[model samples]
Target: MTAADDSPVHQGRRAALVRQLRARGIANEAVLTALGLVPRHLFFDSGLLPQAYQDKAFPIGAGQTISQPYTVAYQSALLAPQPGDRVLEIGTGSGYQACVLVALGAEVHTIELEPSLSARAGRLLARLGASATLYVGDGSVGLPTVAPFSGILVTAGARRVPPALLRQLAVGGRLVVPVGPADGIQRMLRIERESATAFRQETFADFRFVPLRGAEAVAPAPSQSGAETIRSAES
Candidate 1:
């Protein structure tokens, strides 16, 4: 991390980011407060620490990019996890979003497509004193073993809501995701399970995200370090 990571300047930067999010219509007080407390700079490589709090996504490795602060806050606010709610997060990425969920009192179970990124994100979370179960696999399938999630958030853009994710959500649960063509901006969707066979979907904003890779997709080349994972896709 950079020298500013421990300096008051970084803290001030985080505060400023929170204010920016608020100005951009992020009104969830709990989400904003939790975001304010999480040190985003610590999640960055030392070289990129300076841009960590800039509300922009940065490449984390393995063709994946960390979701921007606004995107993270927007999705989390839509999911609206209650304290102690069990949340399943698809695409752990840099694990920044998982940390946010943990801070907001969710029992987070996050999955990543790349093993290296998964390992690296786990260590980062531990360093931040955040707790979340981490898994490396095809997140498109969701975690059936931990099914019935009270909240679900997908960090990548999908062609459509994966059937597995919809099936995993508990009745009355809410899922926030970005869905559209892989090469274009996606429509942010909030799907709420209203009953055993019914769901309600609300479309919000447009966002661009890395494609949500699955079991059928070819694996990315192995990386020596997750922090240095290659960006092969348009994130």
Candidate 2:
């Protein structure tokens, strides 16, 4: 089905999913509204249409899965994008998350490591008129040419926070990523760039995501700077 095929059943399902997200502690009304507007079923294959709004991750080919709705809502809530905010999404799987970001009125630049996924997502986003710029590249390094984003979100699990991404954040920008061993549960972290050389980090609930692919996936040397402060928070 195409993005234009949003019938009553699909609308009902989407609304239900939004309600579920709110009940699960996604307090960002704008994020929830964006989720309510985007048609999730259109991002799925015809065979998986029935499971589209179930708040579960399903394979989207290329060894990736469109993240579960709750995960998307949670991460988006943490990012707290304001209209016109420039945001970079590290993974473009299914382009669903990008669509959600666009619905929130953010300027989204999403990168995917897999060419096939990028192409498919590009076509779908274009058809939906989501207006997100899709790039096929090593997302771990981020899009340096478009540095200084108001927000950067990494959809995959990495060994540690990528320093390159931190460098790309605009002062006061936030980067939300899941960090831990690739094979185990990852702790969701929100790192905020406090100034030119200072950052503050806060940890959230644990989630399991596909391992991030690219050169920086191997654990990188820890940041040598002492200006960064880390704070842990339980969900």
Candidate 3:
């Protein structure tokens, strides 16, 4: 199926997104600029591009759903990304949020567990001229070597905030993750690293997401004693 023209459609959708964002208490202009600039449809199924602006989630292949537009905007606003900040994003599902983050001129490095989805998103993001370091790995690990980022965002739900990710944050940096107990609902959490050893947690209202699965997820990956999987599976 042919996708809608990227410009006109996205412009209209962006206006609507901005309105929703304000209503939801997203007050950052930089975040709004990024949300308005990125073409959300580029990260969606071609056939559904026409409805890309609606405040709802759409199906992405591999059984994952691109987050609803409001959630993306909300999370970005909560993280309060700055133009020069280096942001590490976990779960690049459709690369929509990554695109939005980087479009505001953030230096973005994203990790995705599903190789197939990651590869496809890498190509599409490049086509949009979004500069992001895309890595196919476990989200639970968060991106190491590139630690001490200015901000971090995770797009999946986890039973508990993985402590490893918290350690990677630069002092005063923020890590936004979905944390909740299994069989219970999830809530958006903004964790600020007060120092190398402490974090301040700010919780938000209810939200739903795919469970976080990777080496550090609630369930340990299959391995013999002292052996590691090295990589996560495709979703």
Candidate 4:
């Protein structure tokens, strides 16, 4: 469906999903609430809707998958989003995560390395009535013009947290990423920028994701933002 059903049945499913996240150690009320409100089924094809609220990842094309619901809630809780935070998300994916960020009251700036996905996500977010600036480029390099963001979230697995993303964080800001070998499982990392040149990192649960790609991954910058290159399907 072009929009979430948002009917009683769908809303009940979302509520149950929130309960699942809570039992699984997602303690942030705001994160849980956001996850509960965004209808994950709307991010999937009609055939995949049956699996949308089950807390599992599902492919969304472009060789990418929308992250599992638990993973989304975990990352959102770890990011410790505050209202009005200027958050930079390194991978837009299906825009599900960005929608969560929006629901939590963050001012989001998201970048996707894949043009098609970026455009699709932008339109999806718009249709969901969420506001987030969407960019298509080297997510590994981050959005420099929006440097010093209050928080950052990276959805893909990286060999190492990109230095550029770390540099973009405001002092006292946090950057959550998944880091490890491309063919192996990745550790979810929370890095807090304590000062101009100092940061602290902590490792959380292991997860798997598509390998992040682009200039920081040894590729060139995308020539155009997906916004400039693709006509959003919903539009």
- lDDT (Cα atoms) of all candidates against the true structure: 0.86, 0.91, 0.81, 0.87
Q: Mind giving the per-residue lDDT tens digits that candidate 2 earns over 196-218?
A: 87788898999999999888777
TM-score of 2: 0.94
User: Which portions of model 2 miss their true places by more than 4 Å?
Assistant: 1-4, 223-235
For model 4, what is the alpha-carbon lDDT of residue 96?
Answer: 97
TM-score per candidate, chains pooled: 0.89, 0.94, 0.87, 0.90
Candidates, ranked, lDDT = 2, 4, 1, 3
Cα lDDT tens digits for candidate 4, 1-235: 3433677788899999998889989999999889888988889988997887898999999899999999999899999889999999999999999999999999999998889999889888888889999998888899999888999999999887677887888988988999887889999988888777667787889999899887686543344443112221234
Worst 10 residues of 4 by lDDT: 226-235
lDDT of 2 at 57: 98
Of 1 and 4, the candidate ahead on lDDT is 4
Question: Per-residue alpha-carbon lDDT of model 3 for 1-235, expressed as tens digits?
Answer: 1345466656777888888887878788888878887777777776896778888988787777899977888889888887889999989999999999987778999999889999999998888888899999988888778887999998988887776687788988988988776556799988887765556777787888888888788764334454311121121
lDDT of 3: 0.81
> Highest TM-score: which candidate?
2
Considering TM-score, where higher is better, how would the candidates rank from best to worst?
Answer: 2, 4, 1, 3
Error of 4 at 142 (Å): 0.3
Which portions of model 4 show Cα errors greater than 4 Å? Answer: 1-4, 218-235
Clashes of each: 2, 0, 0, 0
Pick the lDDT winner: 2
How many Å off is the CA of 54 in candidate 2?
0.5
Candidate 4 lDDT for residue 170: 94
Candidate 1, residues 139-181, lDDT tens digits: the string is 8888999899999998998887776777788988988889888
